[model samples]
Target: MTLVKSLYAGIATASFVLAALPAAAEDDVKIVASFSILGDMVEEVVGDLATVTTIVGPDADAHVYQPSVADARAVAQADIIFVNGLGFETWSDTLISESGTEATVHVATAGITPVKVDGMTDPHAWNSLSNGVIYVTNVAAAMKEAMPEHAGEITANADAYIAELEALDAETKSKLADLPANRRTVVTAHDAFGYLADAYGLTFLAPVGIATEAEPSAKDLAVLIDQLKAEGAAALFVENITSPALVQQISEETGIVIGGRLFSDALSERGGPATSYLTMFQHNLGTLLDALAHETAS
Candidate 1:
């Protein structure tokens, strides 16, 4: 009888322990970001608290990305989805609808006052370090709400990241201030740098509008050429996500040197100069400054 009782007690204890094991093991919150830059921000904010899946990857154009069935499946499984709202992702609505995800959707650019161009909102708000802070904050808030158990960790991570963004913003302003006022005008393939221009006191002119999918009309090209000549812009740049054909043509016609590639819409691949948000900003600034400084010397 004593041996039988001990065997029963051991079985009960084993069952209890098995039941408690799952409760002790925490599940990671699943998060999906619309593109690479936002994915980096989400990763920074969540640390290891969540698993981040990015749809549009490095050196890819989010403006023209089409979601696949696998992407929908990932979205459906996400606990939260972060998008860059201001009409940046044209297919985002369809993806969300098709996935029928119950996930909470957060637009990273929620509180930003967007720079408008040609009756359309420029969705590249992340180009500005200040707006990058806002993106991080919104993501952190969403993470806290989705994973309340990890709210403290999310908040701390976000605070530290925002501080770094603030420092980067200060550094950008200082660097831009070093350039001559007349030399601050920049010409690129697309008008994706409106927010950066507004934030850094530079004038950006492009032949094509915000969306790279649309080609520039001949009239638009003519007008941009005239403006470039009038503004005496000496350096032209091509974006990472755009074909350099147009800007290269412009550079040849106008005798403006082709400055190195700028990571405008998307970041470079891993181990590249503009891999992260911070590195992207630094790389762009350095590239621009170096090109313009060479022009100044000449």
Candidate 2:
């Protein structure tokens, strides 16, 4: 896997970027997204207008993805590429350059103000549904520009998709509204939930930092263990893209209940609970509410 580079400053994206891209010559509007979540968002907006390909597959980690020959070939043939750009896919720049492709790389998290933790930019913007709306809107706008013939259909699809997102956002807020300030503490393997916590009135804790590849030092682990024992986490969750060992260890030490698995960085397999972005969010919300709201693990 490729080690993600340092934080980037100007992570920008637009509601659209394929302004000069010619209309689909044949019916193939090939798009390459950086990861599974981004790919699913693109699919929702583009509908069947394009064939979306994801570089990082389900249950995979993008923070340390090493692009393979197959990845290069896909990018080389793609007309457009979407990435989470707040330094999320730090390996992307090298991959796109080496792919020898002229495809336009669009930053999905373009307009959303990024959240930084301990001075490092947090790249998991899609954790917030408001920002998620921006991601698909950007894809839809670019798609409309690239294929004017399907503009009407694209707009309709985007509208419906955005509505569902907004409805769910409201629902999640309502479901979590009564969670007291004290009960909003969420613990996980890494700091991937900063955006989600910010969006839903919850506080998140993790042993390591944002990138799963960065191992936590003994000092860091000790401090976190002390903190958890002191304040206590409402529930512990294991993310799909990360190893469950750290969370299990933490659970054993703290005796905090392990709330079922949460899909943080990736989706699940074809028949699994979280196969797409929407289903992933729904599953995560249900899991958290069940664990945090009711503490059902006992």
Candidate 3:
């Protein structure tokens, strides 16, 4: 597997693939989103005008995701493929080529300047409400380009959706504003919150960096435990998509309470707390506020 270290590299590669697609049919719009989050965004814009399929399902990790034969078949039959560029879906190119998809592929992160984690650009743009708006706009633009007849409708829907995202951004700030500045520090399993931290005026500390696939050393854990104690980290939380064992151990050894389970890489399944993109943000904000509120009250 090629280790993609930068978002710009991923963008360059995606542009190359997108440049290769021939013009597609109008009514035969079939979209294959690389993961469920992008799938949700695409569905919001395209609605009934397109048939959508997601290669990675709800609560699944895209970092080390391998393409199944069925997923390859889905790509093979798609009319257009939408992906979150910036090395989010590393298996995408191989799957698309192997599946023999001649479809046009679009990057939903097209317009936004992606925030990088480590030396590479972090691909989890949907975590920030501001970035989420840009994602929706990119999806709408792609839909419009593919099916010009619905261009006006897609644009209108995107505008309405963006309005809601603007509200979400404001509401998130409002929800987080009550916590004291020192109490805003959060420790999670991975560096998934660069965007969230930048947006909400909170601080994120992870012993582990961009990938949860890696395990922190005993020394690293000890250092982190000390940092949590010295920094007076208000809460520690486990991510929905990562193992809770490390976080539980951190909580136990450090005596810092487990604040909450955060929905990080993937959204929850239908009927769950974070089924939709909006609901996911709401759930995360509520969980964080509850923990911090408890600390403040005491």
Candidate 4:
């Protein structure tokens, strides 16, 4: 049998323990994440504990992700897998099957009650810092369970990470508090920021619904343009995971200057501004504030 099958078989037969395993078995702790953003979060808590890999790379749209054979092979070898769940990767089940991986699947969204994406439950719970805290907790718990000897260390790391996330949650609310009720309306290319909007009291608007797979109808765009003009919208933004052409068209039609690009569904590649979740949130907030401040000035 393949090494993956062997690993799963061993996990099934053995009981949980807290001691270190053999040196040769160290590489067996492979982790597969659904996308770049989730991979980043998993890495922060797990640190150097495992070989982390992501199926959807930077700036890839997860809503319509199609996993490749290579991705399947990677998943098949992992000791554990982390998924955002809540229907984020619509084809995740198929990916798991194709991989033939019996690795335990851990849903990072375990405790997050996600916001609705255009009335339907969306899987992008990481948009909210509170939900991010839940994700880190779940990751730490899964790691500690799988590698028992490291339980105490993993728990301590998770606690420190939780403290940072809590601070970020507070900062988001504080940063957004300056915007008046009417000026709280924000528009973007897709419906990925429902959780962020809900958490910080912003009214989110998107011509396209839950996923970027759907194109905005011309009628919808016209309606959005009219409404934005009437409301004196503070800003419009393009998502990092989506093409900018549509957002540019909307900006041109509405005469609203395009704010800086926002990190929505994905994280930036290494060395980029939004390499981490906290940086991504701060970048988006700064962009919004700059645009709104400009509106106030003019």
Candidate 5:
């Protein structure tokens, strides 16, 4: 009886220790982002307080991304999920439903006034630094709500990041001001830059609609080419997320020089030019200015 009692006590102690082990190991909050850009923002806000898993990574097209089993698993395990939520991730709703996670879903673009084109809300609001401030605010609030113990840290990080975004906004405006007004028209593979155009006072034209999944009609392409020729738009840009073939074909047809690759829907991979949000904006500005400057000089 004495030996049996001792064995039972040891089993209970082992069970208690095993249960407490998870409590000790689960220190960081698990966050899942719908894409790379939002992943970067969440990482910046959470710092070391959370582990962020991005579903659609850098240089990948989220518009057509099909979430895999691993992605669904990540969502299932996440404590919080951040999504852009302007119909940006078409697959996200189904994935979230399938994941069956009770995690809080936060739309990063909650408070911003979205620009609508053809009755569709533009999901690329992050293109404008001013709107980026709103994104950070929403992300910070979500993080605070999820992990109240780290609220102070999250707020400080968000404030610092927003300040950087403000500086980037000012710099973008100043750089764009140097371009000739006539050369301010930008043509890209898709209509991903409406927010950027609206914010920075440039005119953006695209053959295809906002979502890459939407195929551009022959009529649309013809109209865009005619408009480009009529407007004498000098620069055409290829987006990092899209195939350059369509833009290349457009350039060949119109004799408009391909300006450069723009980081439209996604950031560049790590160790690339447009790695971070700040660097992405800087690189894009430089590319536009370089091309526009050349056009103005010619």
Candidate 6:
């Protein structure tokens, strides 16, 4: 289990990163997260009360994730497991089954209503800070279930985490309140920001929808380019998990400059700008405001 945790932390052959910040775990309960985002959430709510292990690490795409042997082993040893579960991790089911883990698998987005795209669940609920509160609530409940003795401590931690989320929610709305309707339209690499757009009054157009499993077809790219040309956009941004090549191509064809990187499905590395879920959203909000709001102000 130790080796498996190390593997997820990228002490071996993987580009993935550690779960969260500098905190020593009590190691009381073994927790497995399907990806870095959930890992960070688990850390925030449970603090050091639980030993959290992540399967998909920093800047890695969970939609197309391939679970490792180490991940399976970790899941097998876990006392609790957290997954986003809107068909987000296609590989999670197989991995959990093969591992024969008896750990209670918790879905962070279980209670929230999901955004649908073409009759498919968007699976990116964490994009909105409001929905993130739901995630933290679910995490806190699961932690209490796993370690009943630490219920008081877990509740306190979850309250702090939720407070932060609520603060950010207010900040987002305040910051974006002045943004005009015409300037609210933005372009991203994929359709992962629907919840965010809905929550904050923005419109996101993308070449790829929901997941990045398939490369955007030429027609899809053409359509996106044409839409941007016809209606215009505030800014075009690329996701951390996706390649900038497609975005670059769209920019060249449509004459819209690429804005900056957005942490869509994953968090950045430990020393990077967005190591935790809160920081990831903060970073993305800043990026958007810098390009859309700041530029408009200037």
For model 3, the superposed segments whose C-alpha errors exceed 4 Å read 1-26, 296-298
A best-first ranking of the candidates according to their lDDT comes to: 5, 2, 6, 1, 3, 4
Candidate 2 Cα outliers beyond 4 Å, as residue runs? 1-25, 295-298
lDDT scores of the candidates, listed in order: 0.84, 0.85, 0.82, 0.80, 0.85, 0.85
Q: Taking the tens digit of each residue's C-alpha lDDT, what string does model 3 give over 13-36?
A: 555565587755657778899988
Each candidate structure's count of clashing pairs: 0, 3, 0, 2, 0, 0
Give the per-residue lDDT of model 2 (tens digit) for 1-298: 2232311111111102233345556768899999999999989888887899999999999998877666766777788899889888878998787556778888888789989987999999989999889998998888888889999999999999999999999999999999877678978898898889899989998888999999999999989989988888888999988889999999889888998899989999899999988999999999998888875332
**Residues forming the 10-long window of minimal summed lDDT in candidate 1:** 17-26
Candidate 5 on 1-298: residue-level lDDT in tens? 5743543444445445444654425666789999988889888999999899999999999999977656766776678999998889998887787566778899999988989978889999999999999999999998898888889999999999999999999989998887778888878988898899999989888888898977888998898888877777858899999989999998888888989999988888978998878888889989998888776312
- Model 3 quality (TM-score): 0.88
- Which regions of candidate 6 are displaced past 4 Å? 1-27, 294-298
Q: After TM-score superposition, what is the CA distance of residue 159 in candidate 2 from its true location, in Å?
A: 0.4
In the predicted model 6, the residue pairs found to clash are none
Candidate 4 TM-score to native: 0.88
Clashing pairs in 3: none
1 versus 4: better lDDT goes to: 1
- Model 1, total clashes: 0
> lDDT of model 2 at residue 87?
88
